[model samples]
Target: MYKVKVFVTLRESVIDPQGTVAKDSLHKLNYGEVSDVRIGKYIELTLEKTDRNIDEIVKEMCEKLLVNLNVEDYRFEIEEVVAQ
Candidate 1:
Protein backbone atom coordinates (compact mmCIF):
# COMPACT_ATOMS: atom_id res chain seq x y z
CA MET A 1 0.00 0.00 0.00
CA TYR A 2 1.02 3.57 -0.69
CA LYS A 3 0.03 6.76 1.08
CA VAL A 4 -1.24 9.79 -0.81
CA LYS A 5 -1.53 13.23 0.74
CA VAL A 6 -3.58 15.76 -1.18
CA PHE A 7 -3.95 19.50 -0.56
CA VAL A 8 -6.74 21.49 -2.20
CA THR A 9 -6.62 25.28 -2.11
CA LEU A 10 -7.99 28.24 -3.98
CA ARG A 11 -6.06 29.75 -6.86
CA GLU A 12 -4.02 32.89 -6.24
CA SER A 13 -6.39 35.28 -7.99
CA VAL A 14 -9.49 33.63 -6.55
CA ILE A 15 -11.33 35.45 -3.78
CA ASP A 16 -12.08 33.43 -0.69
CA PRO A 17 -15.03 34.69 1.34
CA GLN A 18 -14.31 32.20 4.10
CA GLY A 19 -10.81 33.59 4.39
CA THR A 20 -12.15 37.13 4.64
CA VAL A 21 -14.51 36.09 7.42
CA ALA A 22 -11.67 34.50 9.35
CA LYS A 23 -9.50 37.56 8.90
CA ASP A 24 -12.24 39.80 10.20
CA SER A 25 -12.66 37.66 13.27
CA LEU A 26 -8.94 37.64 13.87
CA HIS A 27 -8.75 41.40 13.64
CA LYS A 28 -11.60 41.70 16.14
CA LEU A 29 -9.55 39.51 18.50
CA ASN A 30 -6.55 41.83 18.20
CA TYR A 31 -4.78 39.75 15.55
CA GLY A 32 -4.67 42.35 12.80
CA GLU A 33 -1.31 41.18 11.60
CA VAL A 34 -3.05 38.14 10.18
CA SER A 35 -4.21 39.84 7.04
CA ASP A 36 -5.02 36.67 5.15
CA VAL A 37 -6.65 33.42 6.08
CA ARG A 38 -7.23 30.66 3.54
CA ILE A 39 -9.39 27.66 4.19
CA GLY A 40 -8.75 24.43 2.32
CA LYS A 41 -9.16 20.69 2.52
CA TYR A 42 -6.58 17.98 3.16
CA ILE A 43 -7.23 14.39 2.20
CA GLU A 44 -5.16 11.28 2.71
CA LEU A 45 -5.77 8.10 0.75
CA THR A 46 -4.14 4.73 0.95
CA LEU A 47 -3.82 2.82 -2.31
CA GLU A 48 -3.82 -0.89 -1.96
CA LYS A 49 -2.58 -1.51 -5.44
CA THR A 50 0.75 -0.48 -6.82
CA ASP A 51 2.11 -0.41 -10.32
CA ARG A 52 5.00 1.12 -12.27
CA ASN A 53 3.53 4.61 -12.52
CA ILE A 54 1.51 4.80 -9.34
CA ASP A 55 2.30 8.41 -8.63
CA GLU A 56 1.14 9.60 -12.00
CA ILE A 57 -2.01 7.55 -11.90
CA VAL A 58 -2.86 8.73 -8.38
CA LYS A 59 -2.16 12.35 -9.26
CA GLU A 60 -4.56 12.09 -12.16
CA MET A 61 -7.20 10.68 -9.86
CA CYS A 62 -6.76 13.57 -7.45
CA GLU A 63 -7.10 16.09 -10.22
CA LYS A 64 -10.19 14.41 -11.58
CA LEU A 65 -11.99 13.63 -8.34
CA LEU A 66 -10.45 15.49 -5.39
CA VAL A 67 -9.93 18.96 -6.88
CA ASN A 68 -12.03 21.42 -8.79
CA LEU A 69 -10.00 22.38 -11.85
CA ASN A 70 -11.76 25.67 -12.42
CA VAL A 71 -11.23 27.63 -9.19
CA GLU A 72 -9.03 25.44 -7.04
CA ASP A 73 -5.48 24.12 -7.28
CA TYR A 74 -4.16 20.93 -5.83
CA ARG A 75 -0.87 19.24 -5.05
CA PHE A 76 -0.20 15.72 -3.89
CA GLU A 77 2.66 13.61 -2.63
CA ILE A 78 2.97 9.87 -2.55
CA GLU A 79 5.03 7.74 -0.19
CA GLU A 80 6.06 4.23 -1.08
CA VAL A 81 5.12 1.70 1.50
CA VAL A 82 7.66 -0.82 2.67
CA ALA A 83 6.46 -3.90 4.38
CA GLN A 84 7.89 -4.37 7.86
Candidate 2:
Protein backbone atom coordinates (compact mmCIF):
# COMPACT_ATOMS: atom_id res chain seq x y z
CA MET A 1 0.00 0.00 0.00
CA TYR A 2 0.99 3.60 -0.27
CA LYS A 3 0.27 6.65 1.83
CA VAL A 4 0.05 9.96 0.08
CA LYS A 5 0.24 13.35 1.71
CA VAL A 6 -0.95 16.15 -0.53
CA PHE A 7 -0.37 19.77 0.30
CA VAL A 8 -2.37 22.40 -1.54
CA THR A 9 -1.72 26.09 -1.23
CA LEU A 10 -2.56 29.35 -2.86
CA ARG A 11 -0.05 30.54 -5.43
CA GLU A 12 2.23 33.32 -4.20
CA SER A 13 0.52 35.73 -6.56
CA VAL A 14 -2.87 34.96 -5.07
CA ILE A 15 -4.11 36.78 -2.01
CA ASP A 16 -5.14 34.58 0.89
CA PRO A 17 -7.93 36.37 2.70
CA GLN A 18 -8.46 33.68 5.30
CA GLY A 19 -4.81 33.60 6.19
CA THR A 20 -4.74 37.35 6.42
CA VAL A 21 -7.70 37.31 8.77
CA ALA A 22 -6.09 34.74 11.00
CA LYS A 23 -2.88 36.73 11.14
CA ASP A 24 -4.73 39.90 11.97
CA SER A 25 -6.63 38.14 14.73
CA LEU A 26 -3.44 36.74 16.14
CA HIS A 27 -1.85 40.16 16.15
CA LYS A 28 -4.87 41.53 17.91
CA LEU A 29 -4.43 38.81 20.49
CA ASN A 30 -0.86 40.16 21.01
CA TYR A 31 1.12 37.86 18.79
CA GLY A 32 3.09 40.73 17.36
CA GLU A 33 6.02 38.67 16.15
CA VAL A 34 4.03 36.90 13.46
CA SER A 35 4.92 38.44 10.12
CA ASP A 36 2.47 36.62 7.88
CA VAL A 37 0.25 33.59 7.59
CA ARG A 38 -0.73 31.42 4.65
CA ILE A 39 -3.49 28.86 4.80
CA GLY A 40 -3.35 25.59 2.89
CA LYS A 41 -5.03 22.22 2.66
CA TYR A 42 -3.64 18.85 3.57
CA ILE A 43 -5.05 15.66 2.08
CA GLU A 44 -4.19 12.08 2.84
CA LEU A 45 -4.89 9.18 0.53
CA THR A 46 -4.15 5.47 0.66
CA LEU A 47 -3.84 3.40 -2.46
CA GLU A 48 -3.32 -0.24 -3.09
CA LYS A 49 -0.35 -1.31 -5.15
CA THR A 50 -0.90 -0.70 -8.85
CA ASP A 51 1.00 -1.07 -12.07
CA ARG A 52 0.35 2.55 -12.93
CA ASN A 53 3.03 5.08 -12.13
CA ILE A 54 2.37 6.51 -8.67
CA ASP A 55 3.70 9.94 -9.49
CA GLU A 56 1.55 10.25 -12.57
CA ILE A 57 -1.52 9.04 -10.73
CA VAL A 58 -1.02 11.53 -7.97
CA LYS A 59 -0.39 14.39 -10.37
CA GLU A 60 -3.48 13.51 -12.38
CA MET A 61 -5.64 13.34 -9.29
CA CYS A 62 -4.35 16.64 -8.01
CA GLU A 63 -4.81 18.38 -11.32
CA LYS A 64 -8.18 16.89 -12.07
CA LEU A 65 -9.85 17.17 -8.68
CA LEU A 66 -7.80 17.98 -5.64
CA VAL A 67 -6.47 21.38 -6.66
CA ASN A 68 -7.54 24.45 -8.53
CA LEU A 69 -4.83 24.92 -11.13
CA ASN A 70 -5.55 28.58 -11.71
CA VAL A 71 -5.07 29.80 -8.15
CA GLU A 72 -3.67 26.90 -6.17
CA ASP A 73 -0.55 24.77 -6.43
CA TYR A 74 -0.01 21.33 -4.95
CA ARG A 75 2.75 18.89 -4.14
CA PHE A 76 2.62 15.36 -2.74
CA GLU A 77 4.76 12.90 -0.85
CA ILE A 78 4.30 9.17 -1.24
CA GLU A 79 5.33 6.61 1.31
CA GLU A 80 5.09 2.85 1.09
CA VAL A 81 2.96 1.39 3.89
CA VAL A 82 1.97 -2.03 5.13
CA ALA A 83 -1.72 -2.62 5.22
CA GLN A 84 -3.19 -3.73 8.49
Summed backbone clashes in each candidate are 0, 0
* lDDT scores in order: 0.87, 0.97
Candidate 2 per-residue lDDT, tens place, 1-84, comes to 999999999999999999999999999999999999999999999999999999999999999999999999999999999867
Across 1-84, the per-residue lDDT of candidate 1 in tens digits comes to 888888899998999999999999999999979969999999998888655688788778877788888999988888878779
Predicted model with the maximum TM-score: 2
Candidate 1: stretches off by over 4 Å: none
Clashing pairs in 1: none
